[model samples]
Target: MEKEFNGRDLKLGQIQDGNSDYTRYHITYKSGDLTISGIMNIPKGIPPEDGWPVLFLNHGHIDTSVYTNGRGLRREQDYLARQGFAVLHSDYRNHTQSDKDPNTETDVRLGYVEDVINAVMAVKNSDISSLSKERFGMLGHSMGGGISQAVMVVRPDLVDAIVLYAPVSSDVVDSYNRWTLRNSSNAEKIRSAHGSPEENPEFWKNMSPRTFFDRVKTPIIIFHGTADESCDIEWSRETRELLLAAGKRVELVEYPGQYHEFGATFDDFMKRSSDFFKNNLK
Candidate 1:
């Protein structure tokens, strides 16, 4: 069962000050038996003659569109809207107000990527007047970043470019292994049901962006905090190195002493993110 929030009156200004050209709406995209819910932020005040760029924004693990909405990232979305960009930030199946599919919800990670693809397709095919699919990009944070990478490998045509914040590195198995060891109880339970890194090596390998770097041709910009404790800075560094080695277009930005969710700050994270979109989405 899915509970929906239209957020019809959800003020973008609640997150930050920006032009009033953006309006937020909730959408449901079909994925097999599942109905995935998402938030679409469309830039207003533009004539139908002008075409705007589109960006698919994905939230991190254990997070939702509500968090992004409250944390002022929606303001960043509004800022992009003011700049003539349409942003769709979505909640993966089983998270937040999204519906859960019994078949995929049990494996949350894969469901996240599927929901991302669904969101992108929904935005691309939506009847909404404010969105344009020809100019498309993807922006994601943490686990969402990892999903963005996976999406690039499978559906690069849906996106022209990507911007990742504190993205999880390509070595997903190792990362999960370390995480499992540190947080034994919960990790073990998930592993027991979903299979451990060792048991499901193929799944981990397929999901890893590092392993599929050769398949990625789209330009990518990745940001990470060197002091990040959750996902670690080494992951970003390794990804950067792999992408560079593959002769792919990649830009890596590292912030010193910043931890996970460094972008929660209104000025620092929101401003930098908006700037990145402005520069690359052009």
Candidate 2:
């Protein structure tokens, strides 16, 4: 069973300096009685008239054994903050200090999606002086990109725009098969516990963001590498094609021969991302 999350009654504390221009805070919120912890970056200066526009950042999966808070995409967070935007990145359930959600294979990443949505609600109703309630955006990388797509379908009004980095496939069955083939041992364990995607096609279908693209109205931009070995570049291309076919506002940026993280083109990617958010949110 899934836990119901209330976006109201959010609590934030344990503030620390992210940098000279931004402060990071410890976020404590409810995803149906499970306590989740995350980091929020706020600009030090006075907020704009309505309030400072904020971005809710979603990070891809990391092995929880060594995962720590703010582990994913700190560079991007810092850049976004320095560029005068407030950023919030959730550790997600079971990662870092956040409490764990029940594990399931069929649902796969939906619980993480719920955690991100809960973070969105928490930020929307939060009392942070520097965060604007009306203007909001999202950025996700890899698995996080997949989460972002799912979130857009579930809560289209939560964010004004979204940017994806080397996202995984929206087809849950494909993702499962690919993952299983890559790590057979872990795959067997997972399958034994939750059943294989082949045994549960309907569940996989229900869990896919592609199934709900019609509900997604948020404008989107995606960046992927042609030489990526982790997640096939085709996943992103297929996603972009699907969104276009659905008549949704979307764009895809491809970097030739770049790896999954865009190590060589991080600067260019950040510049385009910053510009996209600035144009859409500000």
Model 1 segments beyond 4 Å from truth?
1-19, 47-50, 63-72, 103-108, 178-195, 263-282
Model 1 poorest 10 in a row by lDDT: 1-10
- Report the number of the highest-lDDT candidate: 2
lDDT of predicted model 1 = 0.67
The TM-score of predicted model 1 comes to 0.80
Residue lDDT tens for model 2, 1-282: 234556655566788566678888877777656678888788888889877788988887788898888789988998898888888888888887887766623346567888788887777777766678888899999889988988888888878899999998988777777775577776776677566777766766777889889989899999999999988999999999999999999999999999888888999999999999999995
User: What TM-scores do the predictions have?
Assistant: 0.80, 0.91
Deviation in angstroms for 72 in model 2? 0.7
CA displacement after TM-score superposition, residue 197 of candidate 1 (Å)? 2.7
The C-alpha stretches of model 2 lying farther than 4 A from their native spots are 1-4, 104-106, 180-195
